[model samples]
Target: MIRDWEKILLVYEQAVEELKIKFKSIRKEYRNTDEYSPIEFVTGRVKKISSIIEKAKKRNISIDSIEDGIEDIAGIRIMCQLVDDIHRVVSLIRDRDGKDLKIVEERDYINNMKESGYRSYHIIIKYPVHTAFGAKEILAEIQIRTLAMNFWATIEHSLNYKFKHNIPKDIKERLKTAADAAFLLDMEMSAIRDEIMDAQQIFQAKSTIVAKILRNIQYLYFSGKIEEIEDIRDRFFDLNEEGDINRLKEFNNYLEKLMDKYNIRKLI
Candidate 1:
């Protein structure tokens, strides 16, 4: 049993690394550019391995022969940016593995979730794992979520752990409220992303100009132009105080009005 556990762990770790690389490549290739890294998603699976063993032992189940019956995180979740992206990612995963990969089970939690619950996608995949000792076939669970959905799920998970589902009424209500907020935030974020990207481009451009000025000033100071640097330093401080990023959005609104009046390109 100990050897089996060790073997399982070894195989599982390698599977996880392989999955991580695959996920990263998929994210990059498809430009799903949200911050959901494979490591972030796979930690739950690693933790569930021990639990799966324990549960199997209780049921007098053969660990080697177990399917979804004794598996916990043999399941995977893939959080996507959009509903369509979820399906695309799933299809990609199915097609990418050249080995003996089998799609054993699937659950579309997004369409199937109960009301007041969050959304996600789940898949069970059976894949061959090769080790120095031998080759073993195992099942893996894949879960996918949108960025906002992932955030809500992660926070809800922590809350469940902290409260153990015996949460007070008020806290439970607050969680529901927060879930609603997360949903709204997701929509708002998606809507404003293009504008944010545009602003980032402007910021990057202005920042380049600022960098050049600072470098020139530094050069002057290094060449013993202390008094001239002091003057530039004062101007630098003034600019810094004026260009505070917290105030930029307000300035952007003003720029919008000015751009409207002048019919020039808007500033961020």
Candidate 2:
């Protein structure tokens, strides 16, 4: 019989946490460099003991072999904004194979949708985790899917649970229809992905400039530059209302010089 369930679970938990941070860091890196990131967000979970036992029994996996047999005990999910982004994330994971993790298997459900209308790309990997005992390797499942695909899958999962995996035929048909609709939405979004990304970049740049301007104004307030603060604040509001990013950037630059003149440290 398998003993030390706590210890086993602790390792899985650690793996999930570490994987989440790694993927999230990738997203942060892209943003920091002012590039579009394929990864929209990441989430992870260690399977609960009860769910693990249920799955093991359902799959005829012996308790002693559960550690090796249950590939998703440590699960990480990467959400992408577009269907193309899903493949990009998979490529990223593949690039790290043999270094950070070893790919044991891959299932492209998006291209080959399950009979139940499920869609996702699954990569089963062997990830090594360092425990107090030693460096032990464990199996983890990484699922990459677009936001639309995730929404459909989430609803299907809940329905499967509620209906005990025997959803009524009518409900099943509706779910399938919804799945196709979701995929269609993904395709449409991918068609205009470039336009969408450009818009987002512009918005991000404008937001950054606005934030810096606000910070400079605040610093001026604290530095007791009361005489010049009103004019600067008025110009900021006017430039903001003009809705011209270039003008805003120029104004921000002027604020930077003003701060420099006063020797006020920039917050950003």
Candidate 3:
């Protein structure tokens, strides 16, 4: 029994870590192309032994059938900036269904929220894990939600734990109200989503330009171009103070040209 539990936990842990990396890489790909990533961040966890046992007991699963009956032993959560992004992420996962993981079921709680006011899109998947023994398929769950929804759900989860899943009627009612408010916030943010995305993109582009320029400057300093570095530093400070992204980008181009002239390998 102990060995069985250890193997189960190990596989679930591996699944969680791999899924987190995969989802995070998707976000990184969008950022690398200077595009707005729908996925703001990802988090994952493998259920603890105690929690698993408790959940299985609550669900009335036989101990022998726990592995197959209890989903969410491995969980991945993707948080988005807007509700629309949640659907996009869900679509993305759907697109990769056959090649990466096979979708077992989908629960659209965002459209049809739970009675407890939980709002998230749940995707149950069978993920293949290659271990020393061989490839084993395990059930994992992915939850997608907007930031506002995540906030409310987090608070509700805490309350549920505190109340042992029997939250008082009064608190439950308040939670439902708060859930609606959170969804309203998401709607308002979605209304201005374009503006927010544009602002974020500009900030990201500026930050990238600054990083590249600084890296080049560091290369110049190390290459014994002290005087040149001083002038470049002053110009950079002036351009930064001007707070013009275009000018900063122009200065960055000039630095690239200068580096080329000096036979300095471009520092990305």
Candidate 4:
């Protein structure tokens, strides 16, 4: 057994790294398709040494029981744009196709906002980390919340830190009001969710097209005739400056037809 605190901390680090890698893979999988992904962004970290020690002392937990008493040593935060997205992410994590990840517990804090105005859905997962010793199962906490909720939680957390987790009554009431405002904002955004998602998808797809165009143009500058390259480049600039997505789409179509002439593979 790894009795050294340093080694145990490294194990926690390994667990966080593994979970981050897996979550990033899920994000990539969604971006490859036309579907809207619930995960806006993912971040993770292992509890700091001093913080771990403080938590253990506060909970009256022995060093040996730290893993059981302090469940958030390995933490991952997933931010979504909508409240529904938060739940979708939770389900996705639970039903995620993987053998190395498993949900051990869940806390629906979003529906049961804390008195401090904190709201987020937390899931405790068991992640298997491979080390020199062998495969070790480590518990990790995953917090899913809307971007607005995250924004409020961030500010409230800062206030709590400055006040030692005990803000004045007035400040606490104001924080609760701010939390309500954030909740309303999320609801307003979710009302037009489909429209926003469509626009975002179109914008992203256009960006991908632009990137592909630039790469192909750069490639052909050396491989193809300068005259043809310059003409295509001019057209690209004209279409871009017009700020017309339809024109851009048409340009992509043109590129597809001309791929044979330039001996270029399909861009999209």
The best candidate in terms of lDDT: 2
After superposition, the stretches of candidate 1 with alpha carbons farther than 4 Å from their true spots are 1-4, 30-45, 48-50, 53-68, 74-79, 97-100, 188-268
Per-candidate RMSD vs. true structure?
10.3, 2.0, 1.7, 2.7
Compare candidates 1 and 2 on lDDT and give the better one: 2
List the lowest-lDDT window of 10 residues for candidate 2.
259-268
True-structure Cα RMSD, model 1:
10.3
Compared with the true structure, the alpha-carbon lDDT of candidate 1 equals: 0.61
State residue 111's C-alpha deviation in candidate 1, in Å. 1.9
lDDT by residue (tens digit), candidate 3, 41-79: 999998888898998898998788888998899999999
Residue lDDT tens for model 2, 68-123:
88899999999999988988999999999999999999999999999988999999
Tens-place lDDT per residue, model 4, 58-118, is 8898888888778899999999999989888888887863666878889998889887778
For candidate 2, list the clashing residue pairs, or say none. Answer: none
Candidate 3 regions exceeding 4 Å error are 1-3, 266-268
Off by over 4 Å in 4: 1-3, 262-268
Candidate 2 clashes: the total is 0
Q: Rate the local accuracy (lDDT) of all candidates.
A: 0.61, 0.91, 0.90, 0.83
Candidate 4 clash pair list:
none
Ten-residue region with minimum lDDT total, candidate 1: 31-40
